[model samples]
Target: MFTLIAAMDENRLIGTGRGGLPWSGITRDKQHFRDYTAGKSLLIGRRTFEEMRGWFRREDRPIVMTRNPDYDPGGHCRVAGDLDDVLALAADSDGEEIVVCGGAELYRLTLPFADRLVLTLLHADFPAREGGVFFPEWENEDFVELRREDFAADNQASPSMTFLYLARRAGSEHADC
Candidate 1:
């Protein structure tokens, strides 16, 4: 199974486009991400993988997607040259879920093949940075909400969040990956 997981604000602001998140320090959201991705093979873009350097666990298998054939992520993770390679990895996952963790491009590239989407929606907004990265546009008709959990902000500094889980609707059309 392929699952696309991410957290975005009301404006869908996900990244600074310079290898950072627009918002940070939400303990609940971080925990939510870790819980969903644990034990899953991760399909991440090169930039996103680099931004997450040293944050992976020994059991977390990551396949970094990049166009550079010689790019190595220092043996901590493997690399995939393109979407074809990513698809093959997913094909061989057996029953293991392959989580599509992102930079925007990777999410846009893998969204079509996602069996499920696990998203964290923050009840707040942040200014869009110059060259900011936003989550790719998706149609709600293509998926059905399976679950949701709402969490109020921990303090005045944090934003309230909603953990949402959705599965691709039966008969929904998806492009072959």
Candidate 2:
């Protein structure tokens, strides 16, 4: 199965222009990411992969998607030239779930193939950074919510958020993202 995972604010802002998240200190959301992605085959864009350097665990199989033919992410990751290559790699995984870890572009490219979405929806909005990275838009009608857990703000440090798990509805057409 292919899963798309991300955290976005109400405005769908996923990252700052500098390739970092705008908000921080959401402990449960951090743990949610770790728990959901652990041991999964990760399909990530080069920029996001670079931003997350040194955070990968030994068991995580990351396939970095980039258009540059000569791009190398060293020996740690397997590189894919395009979405087709990424899909081929995912196909070869022996029943392991392929999680598309993001940057907006990767999420857009892989949305059609996503069987599920695991999202952390923050209740508040942050100022949109100049050239901020937003999550790609997808049709919510195409997926059915499987689970949802709302978290109240613990302090001023983090806003309330919801952990939402959704799966593509059976017989739903793949809407172009």
Candidate 3:
């Protein structure tokens, strides 16, 4: 099964022109991501993979999605042309779950196939000049909140954040809106 993981601001902005996360200093949220996706196979876009290249642990298997067959991630990751290819690879792996780590486009493309969503919702807004990369919007009725933990704004750059775990409700159609 696929579990999508992401962090977004109140405006749903996930990235800035700087090419990484728009916000910083949320160490707890970062740790939550690490703990949750520790041993899972990860499906991520090439840019996202590159941005996080040095941070992946040895046990994490990243399946990078890119159209360029020649592009090399230079790590222990497998390269795939699309999400289907990534899913096929995950199906063959020994891991119990596949986590879709993103660059907005990938999340928008693969969200329908995700069985769970682990999200960090920052209470602050990140306004960009031409708008920034956003987490794909979804309907609340399609998912049931499995868990929620709220953390107050820390002394650093983070805002009040809520970590939410959601599972797709049974019988809900996985349709992209």
Candidate 4:
């Protein structure tokens, strides 16, 4: 399953800068990402790839989609210049699943290509944040609630966090990797 895993807020904000993941000061979000992506192939944008160097040195390594070919992170981090190239690489990989990590524009581009979504909904309204990116809409009916964890208001992580494991309806995918 090609899955998109992201932590987001109610107002539809993911990040503000070029490629920042705007999770509201939640430590659990990092854990969530790390756990889900531990032994998998993580797809990311150019800036995200740069920010997250040496973190995803998993057995499978990670694939990064960027505009530059000079991005040589060495060891396991492969760069795909565009969506088609990224899809092609994913298509050929032996792994049954791929984790689509984001930086906004990359997420939007990946939406149409994904078969599942692993989302974290943070129930805290944020103040005036700078311009950021949002996740593309996938209807509620298309998801299956696999796991959910709720946090108290004073919790160090978040007030109320919901982890969603959403599978695209059968036959939604054009091809399988």
Candidate 5:
């Protein structure tokens, strides 16, 4: 199954830059990603791919979707010019699974295609901006809660944040909210 796991906030700010900006000040979310994605295929945008470039490869690649035809694979990985291509390649992979690690725009685009979501809902987003570049929101009936994990008490710096694993229901459209 195709899965997308993200660490975001209640205000829904997924990221501002690349690797350097994730909510890594917290550790449980980090461990969840590591444990979940260590040996799986990951799908990402060019910027996200570049951010984690040195750490991944074409063979163990996190696939990148881009418009630049000149885009280089750099290794045994794959690149797609559009969503159809991304979905096709992911579905055809021997493992039949893909995980998305992102910058928010990609999340917005991928939500319609994803089957499962692993989210870390932070207590707050940026102060004034609050939320930026978020995926379309879905109602509670749209998903089934598979699990929830509380962050360590010491990390109350963002109290409302809670980690969640939700499976999107079949036949749903992730319309923009």
Candidate 6:
């Protein structure tokens, strides 16, 4: 199965800049991300991979998508030329699910193939142009929310957060919208 995971602000902003995230102090959210993706195979964009240079553990398998055929990821992580190559690698993986880790373009490109979405929604909005890179717009009707947990604002971050697990409903069409 294919899964997409991300943390976004109220405005659906997944990123604040090219190489950084908007909010920094999401300790719990970070743990959730690690726990959920630890043993899975990840498909991430080159920029995302660069931003996460040393963060990956030994057990994690990361496939970076990039157009440069000679780009070296400098670790066990592999490189793919495009989404089709990423999917082909995932198809050969032994993991239970393949996680689509981000950078806006990769998310938009793979949304149609995702079976599940694991999102952490921050309750605050960081307005656009503050380096806002959006998560692709999606329809709620396409997936069934399987679980939700709310976390109160903590010392590390001011905004409360909600963790949502959604599975694409069987028979739902995967449209471009």
Predicted candidate 1 versus true structure: per-residue lDDT over 59-151, tens digit per residue:
788899999999979865878998778767756765267899998998998888888999999998887777689988889999999999998
Per model, state how many residue pairs clash.
0, 0, 0, 0, 2, 0
List candidate 3 stretches off by more than 4 Å. 175-177
Q: Candidate 3: worst 10 consecutive residues by lDDT?
A: 124-133
Q: What is the C-alpha lDDT of each candidate?
A: 0.86, 0.86, 0.85, 0.72, 0.70, 0.86
> Which pairs of residues clash in candidate 3, taking residues 3 or more apart in a chain or in different chains?
none
lDDT per residue, candidate 2, 1-177, as tens digits?
678999999999999987788887788888899999888789889999998889898888899999998998876688999766876786777635889999898898888878899999999989878778998887888999999999899878678999999999999856432
Give per-residue CA lDDT, model 4, range 20-95, as digits (tens). Answer: 5554457777788888887776788778778877676557558888777787867867888876676667677765
Q: What TM-score do all the candidates reach, one by one?
A: 0.94, 0.92, 0.93, 0.82, 0.78, 0.92
Where in model 2 is the C-alpha error above 4 Å? 175-177
User: On lDDT, who's better, 3 or 5?
Assistant: 3
Q: What's the CA RMSD for each of the models?
A: 1.4, 2.0, 2.0, 2.8, 3.8, 2.2
* Cα shift from native, residue 129, model 2 (Å): 1.0
The global Cα lDDT (0 to 1) of model 1 is 0.86
Residues 88-170, candidate 5, lDDT per residue (tens digit)?
78767765677888766677777767678888777665542333455457577778899987754465553555778898766
**lDDT agreement of model 4 with the native:** 0.72
> Quick one: how many clashes does candidate 5 have?
2
Candidate 6 residues lying further than 4 Å off, grouped into runs, are 156-158, 175-177
> Which prediction has more favorable lDDT, 5 or 6?
6
